[model samples]
Target: MKQTDEVDDLLTRAGARWRADQEAPPEPDLEYMLSGGRKHRRWVPALAAASVAVIAAGVIAVLPDPKTPTAPTAQAPSTTAATPDARTPQTIAQGNDDFLVKPGDKVQVSGKIIAVPGKTPVFCPPLAVPDIGYPPGKEPAPSCPDNFAVKLNGLDLGQIPGLSTIKGVLSGEATVTGTWRGGAIDVDVQTALKPLDHPAQTELECPVPPGGWKSQPSNISSTAVTKFLAAHAYQATGPIFRYPNGTSRGAPVVILIGLAHGDADAFRQAFEKVYRGNYCVVPTLLSQSDEQRVTNAIGDVMSGNPKLGIYSASGPGLYGGRALAQVTAYTPEVKAALTPAGLDLIRVIPQVRPVR
Candidate 1:
């Protein structure tokens, strides 16, 4: 049989079964109709009973009164308004624009990772153009005024060789999540998309040196400088003689010591010891004016110019009767400048020296 015909046959059988299972309605009261009446009377009573039954049926059809109302079934939750499964990437450009990416912003930024000469292990590998200026008493301005820096914390750029020098500029695209921290935009590199191009060396304009050095002699005792240096892993084999006259140009001289690498505390301690020491051959011959000049020059080299390139400074110790300054050098510019100022410059060579 065809599908429709079979379905109809099955429905008909089911309906018949349903009807058979239901109880039959009571028979009509024919006895009441025949009793207490003549043949005409019986016919009238039957008609009246029929009319009453019709009225009752009509009333039931008009108004339905069920015993219990059914409750609405619980519906499954809709997934129509759920969060998106994918995020759209934001683009950031280089230069002096005020486009700041806040913490948790996923972005695609393209720029060159320019090498900062002296801000190593801290602000190294900053994402900027070369020759960024840092105004005195202010933060270093972004290389591209419109663009900001992305610090790749815990991410090794060294995996790509030659990335940390003036000879090379690492230009690439990175997918990152930005984090604003420590007054700068720090980024977590999700993916280094690609190396776009090699960076070319750009000329950096050095800031002009300040006029007239302000002298502030070290106040730290020689004992303190010696003790601090030894505690902080410095080879303190000095108090070495620089001036045979025990004075630098009629000024009492102290010992000069150079340090290749040390923090601010170490620098200050070394400066104080050398400045305060009375190691001059003729203590009376030592000139306070010469000592102040030497101290001022050291301060200028250490703090005045942002790019002075003297990692550490010490001394005004006696060297041939003239006050000399001992310093650790990472750049040639500092030596050139200090040498012209008449302060003897001793370059500290970096090496592991046995503790004395």
Candidate 2:
């Protein structure tokens, strides 16, 4: 057999051999739940692991009652990743505006190389593959006994260097660029994922005063603040930090916090007695608890898909009080699968979108 064909045979055999046991997803951290859920920047360990999404205790109260609902409102799908129509290989490669890549196209992707005991390593799109695990209707692929990830949408980085050295799962993360060969990514270049020594500086919403904001010792303990915020889940958001306009990425961070709704003077009155640093109280649109409630609701909605392997990640966005979810691929069928999820509180985005 040709050397390339020999390698292909090796991958086919390896993929058909291994089976993986599923780890039970983790439970929610009660404290994190109270701490005002974070933006996309911070990872909630347990929630990230289990992909916990909330569902309503009964029918969603936010949803309009089916019997007397007025005319359905039209919402344009949010992200460019969600296409106007179902994508095909030809459309993706031929139409520059259609999608990113297609069969036989060159592509570069970064992620971990996952290798189980008898299976050859396949490049797992660590970031692209949703932390939410398999979408609602799909089976766990690692447990399946078949040639896996050998498809156009997948990156099968066949037989990379160092596979002989590792014993368990994962080859860490790396940048891989290759030509799509209909079934696998024909490797062209590979390199380690470099760490960012210096990330772009971020600024505070409130401009720094002349002398700059300094952290002053607070008589109000952190635990006390957490307890206070926890009780006032309706209006309080946990403390937020940002660097002064030109400060380096690392800390001596400036801290700003807001508590549940109260008059501006009253907010100053409460904090002035305890806090020495700057803080602001803003109006609340939706609480973290409310976002979490709808988040879980959407989780139930997203899992309705039976077509399998549509990955997703979901959580609250940084600024807007809306919960957001990004699906790996979404079609009219998949959209149909996710029903009455029509809540305004949440937005569903598909990375591999179908165009209209």
TM-scores for candidates 1 onward, in order: 0.20, 0.42
Question: What TM-score number comes out for model 1?
Answer: 0.20
lDDT of each: 0.28, 0.36
Q: What's the TM for model 2?
A: 0.42
Choose the strongest candidate by lDDT.
2
Model 2 RMSD, rounded to 1 decimal: 16.6
Stretches off by above 4 angstroms in model 2 are 1-124, 127-150, 153-204, 209-211, 245-253, 258-276, 282-286, 301-314, 317-321, 333-344, 347-349, 353-356
Stretches of model 1 off by over 4 angstroms after superposition: 1-287, 316-330, 343-356
lDDT of candidate 1 over 1-356, digit per residue (tens): 21112223223333332322223322132223223342221111111322321221111010111111111112221111111122211111111012223334333333344334343212222211223356654544223212123344444455433343322333333433344432233545435444222223111111222442112223233456546634532212132222223221232222333221223344555555545532211111112222334335555654554343232232212121222222222223544565533422222211101111
lDDT of 2 at 300: 56
Most TM-score-accurate candidate:
2
